[model samples]
Target: MMKYLRYALLAVAFLLCVTVALANRAPVTLALWPDTVTAFLGFGYAVTLPLFAIVGGAVGLGLVFGLVWEWLREHAQRAEAAKMRRELEQMRRAHPETAARGATQPPRDKVLAILDEADGSS
Candidate 1:
Protein backbone atom coordinates (compact mmCIF):
# COMPACT_ATOMS: atom_id res chain seq x y z
CA MET A 1 0.00 0.00 0.00
CA MET A 2 2.79 2.40 0.86
CA LYS A 3 4.61 1.50 -2.36
CA TYR A 4 1.53 2.22 -4.40
CA LEU A 5 0.96 5.55 -2.70
CA ARG A 6 4.55 6.57 -3.43
CA TYR A 7 4.12 5.66 -7.09
CA ALA A 8 0.92 7.66 -7.29
CA LEU A 9 2.63 10.70 -5.81
CA LEU A 10 5.47 10.36 -8.31
CA ALA A 11 3.01 10.13 -11.21
CA VAL A 12 1.19 13.21 -10.04
CA ALA A 13 4.44 15.15 -9.81
CA PHE A 14 5.43 14.05 -13.32
CA LEU A 15 2.07 15.11 -14.73
CA LEU A 16 2.35 18.50 -13.06
CA CYS A 17 5.82 19.09 -14.47
CA VAL A 18 4.72 17.97 -17.94
CA THR A 19 1.73 20.23 -17.83
CA VAL A 20 3.87 23.19 -16.83
CA ALA A 21 6.41 22.51 -19.57
CA LEU A 22 3.67 22.12 -22.17
CA ALA A 23 1.71 25.19 -21.25
CA ASN A 24 4.81 27.37 -20.98
CA ARG A 25 6.50 27.19 -24.36
CA ALA A 26 7.25 30.80 -25.19
CA PRO A 27 10.07 32.84 -23.67
CA VAL A 28 9.84 36.24 -22.00
CA THR A 29 12.28 38.70 -20.48
CA LEU A 30 13.15 38.53 -16.75
CA ALA A 31 14.13 41.35 -14.49
CA LEU A 32 16.55 39.60 -12.15
CA TRP A 33 18.38 41.15 -9.19
CA PRO A 34 20.09 44.43 -10.26
CA ASP A 35 19.56 43.65 -13.92
CA THR A 36 16.64 44.12 -16.33
CA VAL A 37 18.06 41.75 -18.93
CA THR A 38 16.25 40.68 -22.08
CA ALA A 39 16.88 37.03 -21.21
CA PHE A 40 13.95 34.86 -22.35
CA LEU A 41 12.81 32.31 -19.78
CA GLY A 42 10.29 29.62 -20.66
CA PHE A 43 8.43 30.12 -17.40
CA GLY A 44 7.74 33.66 -18.47
CA TYR A 45 5.30 32.41 -21.12
CA ALA A 46 2.79 31.13 -18.52
CA VAL A 47 3.87 32.45 -15.18
CA THR A 48 1.06 30.75 -13.32
CA LEU A 49 2.15 27.24 -14.39
CA PRO A 50 5.59 27.34 -12.74
CA LEU A 51 4.16 29.18 -9.78
CA PHE A 52 1.65 26.39 -9.32
CA ALA A 53 4.35 23.72 -9.63
CA ILE A 54 6.60 25.41 -7.08
CA VAL A 55 3.82 25.90 -4.56
CA GLY A 56 2.30 22.44 -5.10
CA GLY A 57 5.66 20.66 -4.90
CA ALA A 58 6.53 22.42 -1.67
CA VAL A 59 3.16 21.57 -0.14
CA GLY A 60 3.35 17.95 -1.33
CA LEU A 61 6.82 17.49 0.11
CA GLY A 62 5.66 19.02 3.37
CA LEU A 63 2.75 16.56 3.53
CA VAL A 64 5.00 13.58 2.92
CA PHE A 65 7.45 14.80 5.54
CA GLY A 66 4.70 15.30 8.09
CA LEU A 67 3.30 11.83 7.42
CA VAL A 68 6.67 10.18 7.88
CA TRP A 69 7.35 12.17 11.03
CA GLU A 70 4.01 11.22 12.54
CA TRP A 71 4.45 7.56 11.70
CA LEU A 72 7.88 7.47 13.29
CA ARG A 73 6.67 9.29 16.37
CA GLU A 74 3.69 6.99 16.81
CA HIS A 75 5.85 3.93 16.30
CA ALA A 76 8.23 5.12 19.00
CA GLN A 77 5.39 5.81 21.39
CA ARG A 78 3.83 2.36 20.87
CA ALA A 79 7.19 0.70 21.35
CA GLU A 80 7.69 2.52 24.63
CA ALA A 81 4.20 1.61 25.79
CA ALA A 82 4.78 -2.01 24.89
CA LYS A 83 8.04 -2.04 26.85
CA MET A 84 6.33 -0.59 29.89
CA ARG A 85 3.50 -3.10 29.61
CA ARG A 86 5.95 -5.95 29.41
CA GLU A 87 7.83 -4.67 32.44
CA LEU A 88 4.62 -4.42 34.45
CA GLU A 89 3.58 -7.91 33.42
CA GLN A 90 6.96 -9.26 34.41
CA MET A 91 6.74 -7.59 37.82
CA ARG A 92 3.30 -8.99 38.39
CA ARG A 93 4.42 -12.44 37.35
CA ALA A 94 7.55 -12.37 39.53
CA HIS A 95 6.08 -10.92 42.73
CA PRO A 96 3.82 -13.44 44.45
CA GLU A 97 3.19 -11.10 47.39
CA THR A 98 1.84 -8.38 45.08
CA ALA A 99 -0.33 -10.89 43.26
CA ALA A 100 -1.61 -12.32 46.55
CA ARG A 101 -2.49 -8.92 47.94
CA GLY A 102 -4.24 -7.95 44.74
CA ALA A 103 -6.15 -11.22 44.72
CA THR A 104 -7.08 -10.95 48.45
CA GLN A 105 -8.75 -7.59 47.97
CA PRO A 106 -12.46 -7.82 48.87
CA PRO A 107 -14.76 -8.81 46.10
CA ARG A 108 -18.20 -7.24 45.46
CA ASP A 109 -19.83 -10.31 47.01
CA LYS A 110 -19.02 -9.17 50.56
CA VAL A 111 -20.59 -5.77 50.02
CA LEU A 112 -23.74 -7.36 48.59
CA ALA A 113 -23.87 -9.76 51.57
CA ILE A 114 -23.58 -6.85 54.03
CA LEU A 115 -26.35 -4.97 52.22
CA ASP A 116 -28.57 -8.01 52.34
CA GLU A 117 -28.06 -8.40 56.10
CA ALA A 118 -28.77 -4.71 56.74
CA ASP A 119 -31.98 -4.85 54.69
CA GLY A 120 -33.13 -7.96 56.54
CA SER A 121 -32.62 -6.25 59.93
CA SER A 122 -34.48 -3.10 58.80
Candidate 2:
Protein backbone atom coordinates (compact mmCIF):
# COMPACT_ATOMS: atom_id res chain seq x y z
CA MET A 1 0.00 0.00 0.00
CA MET A 2 2.74 2.45 0.87
CA LYS A 3 4.61 1.54 -2.32
CA TYR A 4 1.50 2.20 -4.41
CA LEU A 5 0.92 5.51 -2.68
CA ARG A 6 4.52 6.53 -3.29
CA TYR A 7 4.18 5.60 -6.98
CA ALA A 8 0.98 7.61 -7.26
CA LEU A 9 2.64 10.62 -5.69
CA LEU A 10 5.59 10.34 -8.07
CA ALA A 11 3.23 10.05 -11.04
CA VAL A 12 1.40 13.18 -9.92
CA ALA A 13 4.65 15.08 -9.54
CA PHE A 14 5.88 13.94 -12.97
CA LEU A 15 2.61 15.06 -14.54
CA LEU A 16 2.89 18.42 -12.80
CA CYS A 17 6.45 18.87 -14.08
CA VAL A 18 5.40 17.92 -17.62
CA THR A 19 2.48 20.36 -17.44
CA VAL A 20 4.81 23.13 -16.21
CA ALA A 21 7.32 22.40 -18.96
CA LEU A 22 4.62 22.40 -21.64
CA ALA A 23 3.02 25.55 -20.29
CA ASN A 24 6.38 27.34 -20.04
CA ARG A 25 7.96 26.40 -23.37
CA ALA A 26 9.35 29.90 -23.85
CA PRO A 27 13.14 30.17 -24.04
CA VAL A 28 14.92 32.15 -21.33
CA THR A 29 18.49 33.45 -21.40
CA LEU A 30 20.60 32.77 -18.30
CA ALA A 31 23.50 35.17 -18.05
CA LEU A 32 26.43 34.83 -15.74
CA TRP A 33 26.79 38.58 -15.30
CA PRO A 34 24.85 41.85 -15.71
CA ASP A 35 25.23 43.88 -18.91
CA THR A 36 27.50 46.40 -17.16
CA VAL A 37 29.70 43.66 -15.73
CA THR A 38 29.86 41.93 -19.11
CA ALA A 39 30.93 45.15 -20.77
CA PHE A 40 33.71 45.63 -18.19
CA LEU A 41 34.86 41.97 -18.44
CA GLY A 42 34.82 41.99 -22.25
CA PHE A 43 33.79 38.34 -22.08
CA GLY A 44 30.72 36.82 -20.44
CA TYR A 45 29.00 33.46 -20.52
CA ALA A 46 25.30 32.74 -20.95
CA VAL A 47 22.94 30.02 -22.06
CA THR A 48 19.44 29.86 -23.47
CA LEU A 49 17.14 27.18 -22.08
CA PRO A 50 13.50 26.59 -21.39
CA LEU A 51 12.09 28.16 -18.20
CA PHE A 52 11.31 24.70 -16.89
CA ALA A 53 14.96 23.66 -17.26
CA ILE A 54 16.11 26.60 -15.15
CA VAL A 55 13.52 25.88 -12.48
CA GLY A 56 14.34 22.17 -12.42
CA GLY A 57 18.07 22.79 -12.30
CA ALA A 58 17.67 25.20 -9.37
CA VAL A 59 15.51 22.72 -7.48
CA GLY A 60 17.98 19.87 -8.07
CA LEU A 61 20.89 22.01 -6.88
CA GLY A 62 18.96 23.05 -3.78
CA LEU A 63 18.22 19.41 -2.90
CA VAL A 64 21.83 18.35 -3.35
CA PHE A 65 23.14 21.18 -1.19
CA GLY A 66 20.52 20.58 1.47
CA LEU A 67 21.42 16.88 1.72
CA VAL A 68 25.13 17.66 1.96
CA TRP A 69 24.47 20.35 4.58
CA GLU A 70 22.44 17.94 6.72
CA TRP A 71 25.07 15.19 6.46
CA LEU A 72 27.82 17.58 7.49
CA ARG A 73 25.72 18.91 10.37
CA GLU A 74 25.25 15.37 11.75
CA HIS A 75 28.95 14.43 11.49
CA ALA A 76 29.59 14.99 15.20
CA GLN A 77 26.61 12.83 16.18
CA ARG A 78 27.73 10.05 13.89
CA ALA A 79 31.25 10.17 15.34
CA GLU A 80 29.90 10.05 18.88
CA ALA A 81 27.72 7.03 18.08
CA ALA A 82 30.68 5.25 16.54
CA LYS A 83 32.76 6.01 19.63
CA MET A 84 30.04 4.58 21.90
CA ARG A 85 29.84 1.40 19.81
CA ARG A 86 33.61 0.94 20.05
CA GLU A 87 33.56 1.46 23.82
CA LEU A 88 30.72 -1.07 24.22
CA GLU A 89 32.63 -3.62 22.20
CA GLN A 90 35.75 -3.05 24.29
CA MET A 91 33.78 -3.60 27.52
CA ARG A 92 32.28 -6.84 26.18
CA ARG A 93 35.72 -8.07 25.19
CA ALA A 94 37.18 -7.12 28.56
CA HIS A 95 34.48 -9.13 30.38
CA PRO A 96 33.63 -11.97 28.05
CA GLU A 97 32.38 -14.23 30.85
CA THR A 98 29.96 -11.58 32.17
CA ALA A 99 28.73 -10.79 28.67
CA ALA A 100 28.10 -14.48 27.88
CA ARG A 101 26.36 -15.06 31.21
CA GLY A 102 24.18 -11.99 30.74
CA ALA A 103 23.00 -13.19 27.31
CA THR A 104 22.14 -16.68 28.59
CA GLN A 105 20.41 -15.74 31.86
CA PRO A 106 17.24 -13.81 32.57
CA PRO A 107 17.84 -10.44 34.16
CA ARG A 108 18.10 -10.53 37.93
CA ASP A 109 15.79 -8.28 39.92
CA LYS A 110 17.52 -5.49 41.88
CA VAL A 111 15.99 -6.70 45.14
CA LEU A 112 17.20 -10.24 44.49
CA ALA A 113 20.65 -8.95 43.65
CA ILE A 114 20.79 -6.91 46.89
CA LEU A 115 19.61 -9.90 48.99
CA ASP A 116 22.17 -12.15 47.33
CA GLU A 117 24.89 -9.63 48.04
CA ALA A 118 23.85 -9.39 51.74
CA ASP A 119 23.77 -13.19 52.14
CA GLY A 120 27.15 -13.55 50.51
CA SER A 121 28.62 -10.84 52.76
CA SER A 122 27.21 -12.38 55.93
Candidate 3:
Protein backbone atom coordinates (compact mmCIF):
# COMPACT_ATOMS: atom_id res chain seq x y z
CA MET A 1 0.00 0.00 0.00
CA MET A 2 2.76 2.44 0.91
CA LYS A 3 4.65 1.55 -2.27
CA TYR A 4 1.57 2.16 -4.43
CA LEU A 5 0.95 5.50 -2.77
CA ARG A 6 4.56 6.53 -3.35
CA TYR A 7 4.33 5.57 -7.02
CA ALA A 8 1.06 7.48 -7.39
CA LEU A 9 2.59 10.59 -5.90
CA LEU A 10 5.62 10.26 -8.16
CA ALA A 11 3.41 9.91 -11.26
CA VAL A 12 1.43 13.02 -10.30
CA ALA A 13 4.60 15.03 -9.73
CA PHE A 14 6.02 13.88 -13.09
CA LEU A 15 2.85 14.94 -14.87
CA LEU A 16 2.93 18.35 -13.20
CA CYS A 17 6.57 18.86 -14.16
CA VAL A 18 5.84 17.89 -17.75
CA THR A 19 2.95 20.35 -17.89
CA VAL A 20 5.11 23.16 -16.52
CA ALA A 21 7.91 22.36 -18.96
CA LEU A 22 5.51 22.43 -21.92
CA ALA A 23 4.04 25.73 -20.79
CA ASN A 24 7.49 27.30 -20.31
CA ARG A 25 9.16 26.25 -23.53
CA ALA A 26 10.77 29.60 -24.17
CA PRO A 27 14.54 30.02 -23.76
CA VAL A 28 15.68 32.26 -20.92
CA THR A 29 19.02 34.00 -20.65
CA LEU A 30 20.83 33.39 -17.35
CA ALA A 31 23.57 35.89 -16.54
CA LEU A 32 26.29 35.69 -13.94
CA TRP A 33 26.26 39.52 -13.62
CA PRO A 34 24.48 42.60 -14.95
CA ASP A 35 25.80 44.28 -18.13
CA THR A 36 27.20 47.25 -16.19
CA VAL A 37 28.95 44.97 -13.71
CA THR A 38 30.38 42.88 -16.50
CA ALA A 39 31.65 46.00 -18.26
CA PHE A 40 33.37 47.22 -15.07
CA LEU A 41 34.77 43.79 -14.20
CA GLY A 42 35.72 42.89 -17.80
CA PHE A 43 34.53 39.34 -17.19
CA GLY A 44 31.12 37.77 -17.03
CA TYR A 45 29.21 34.89 -18.50
CA ALA A 46 25.66 34.17 -19.66
CA VAL A 47 23.88 31.14 -21.03
CA THR A 48 20.59 30.51 -22.74
CA LEU A 49 18.59 27.71 -21.08
CA PRO A 50 15.07 26.53 -21.06
CA LEU A 51 13.05 28.04 -18.17
CA PHE A 52 12.21 24.61 -16.82
CA ALA A 53 15.83 23.54 -16.99
CA ILE A 54 16.93 26.59 -14.99
CA VAL A 55 14.25 26.01 -12.37
CA GLY A 56 15.01 22.29 -12.12
CA GLY A 57 18.76 22.95 -11.88
CA ALA A 58 18.25 25.42 -9.04
CA VAL A 59 16.04 22.97 -7.16
CA GLY A 60 18.55 20.15 -7.63
CA LEU A 61 21.40 22.33 -6.38
CA GLY A 62 19.36 23.38 -3.35
CA LEU A 63 18.63 19.72 -2.48
CA VAL A 64 22.32 18.81 -2.79
CA PHE A 65 23.35 21.73 -0.57
CA GLY A 66 20.72 20.86 2.04
CA LEU A 67 21.90 17.23 2.17
CA VAL A 68 25.53 18.30 2.59
CA TRP A 69 24.59 20.80 5.31
CA GLU A 70 22.63 18.16 7.22
CA TRP A 71 25.44 15.58 6.94
CA LEU A 72 27.95 18.12 8.28
CA ARG A 73 25.63 19.16 11.11
CA GLU A 74 25.12 15.54 12.23
CA HIS A 75 28.81 14.67 12.29
CA ALA A 76 29.03 15.04 16.07
CA GLN A 77 25.98 12.83 16.63
CA ARG A 78 27.37 10.12 14.37
CA ALA A 79 30.66 10.22 16.21
CA GLU A 80 28.89 9.98 19.58
CA ALA A 81 26.85 6.98 18.43
CA ALA A 82 30.00 5.21 17.25
CA LYS A 83 31.75 5.95 20.56
CA MET A 84 28.82 4.58 22.58
CA ARG A 85 28.69 1.40 20.46
CA ARG A 86 32.39 0.80 21.07
CA GLU A 87 31.92 1.38 24.80
CA LEU A 88 29.06 -1.14 24.86
CA GLU A 89 31.23 -3.79 23.18
CA GLN A 90 34.04 -3.14 25.66
CA MET A 91 31.68 -3.44 28.64
CA ARG A 92 30.25 -6.69 27.28
CA ARG A 93 33.74 -8.10 26.98
CA ALA A 94 34.83 -6.90 30.44
CA HIS A 95 31.84 -8.36 32.37
CA PRO A 96 31.21 -12.02 31.54
CA GLU A 97 28.40 -12.24 34.15
CA THR A 98 26.47 -9.33 32.59
CA ALA A 99 26.90 -10.82 29.10
CA ALA A 100 25.62 -14.19 30.34
CA ARG A 101 22.61 -12.51 31.97
CA GLY A 102 21.76 -10.81 28.73
CA ALA A 103 22.12 -14.03 26.75
CA THR A 104 19.86 -15.94 29.20
CA GLN A 105 17.05 -13.42 29.01
CA PRO A 106 13.93 -14.50 27.12
CA PRO A 107 12.81 -12.78 23.94
CA ARG A 108 11.00 -9.54 24.78
CA ASP A 109 8.37 -9.85 22.10
CA LYS A 110 5.38 -11.99 23.13
CA VAL A 111 5.19 -13.87 19.83
CA LEU A 112 8.89 -14.74 19.90
CA ALA A 113 8.68 -15.83 23.54
CA ILE A 114 5.78 -18.12 22.77
CA LEU A 115 7.64 -19.63 19.88
CA ASP A 116 10.68 -20.22 22.07
CA GLU A 117 8.54 -21.92 24.70
CA ALA A 118 6.93 -24.13 22.09
CA ASP A 119 10.30 -25.11 20.71
CA GLY A 120 11.64 -25.89 24.18
CA SER A 121 8.66 -28.23 24.89
CA SER A 122 8.91 -30.03 21.54
In angstroms, the error of model 2 at 50 is 0.8
- Superposition TM-score, candidate 1 onto the true structure: 0.30
Task: Return the TM-score for each candidate structure.
Answer: 0.30, 0.79, 0.81
TM-score of 2: 0.79
**CA lDDT of each prediction against the hidden true structure:** 0.74, 0.97, 0.96
Q: List the residue pairs that clash in candidate 2.
A: none
Taking every candidate in turn, the Cα RMSD to the unseen true structure, in Å, is: 12.0, 6.7, 7.9
Q: Write the per-residue lDDT of candidate 2 for residues 55-109, one digit (tens) a residue.
A: 9999999999999999999999999999999999999999999999889998889
Judge candidate 1 against the unseen true structure and give its global Cα lDDT, from 0 to 1.
0.74
Model 2: worst 10 consecutive residues (lDDT sum): 99-108
Candidate 1, residues 63-85, lDDT tens digits: the string is: 99999999987997899999999
Q: What ranges in model 3 sit over 4 Å off?
A: 107-122
CA-RMSD of model 2: 6.7
lDDT of 3 by residue, 1-122 (tens): 99999999999999999999999989999999999999999999999999999999999999999999999999999999999999999999899899999899875998888999999999
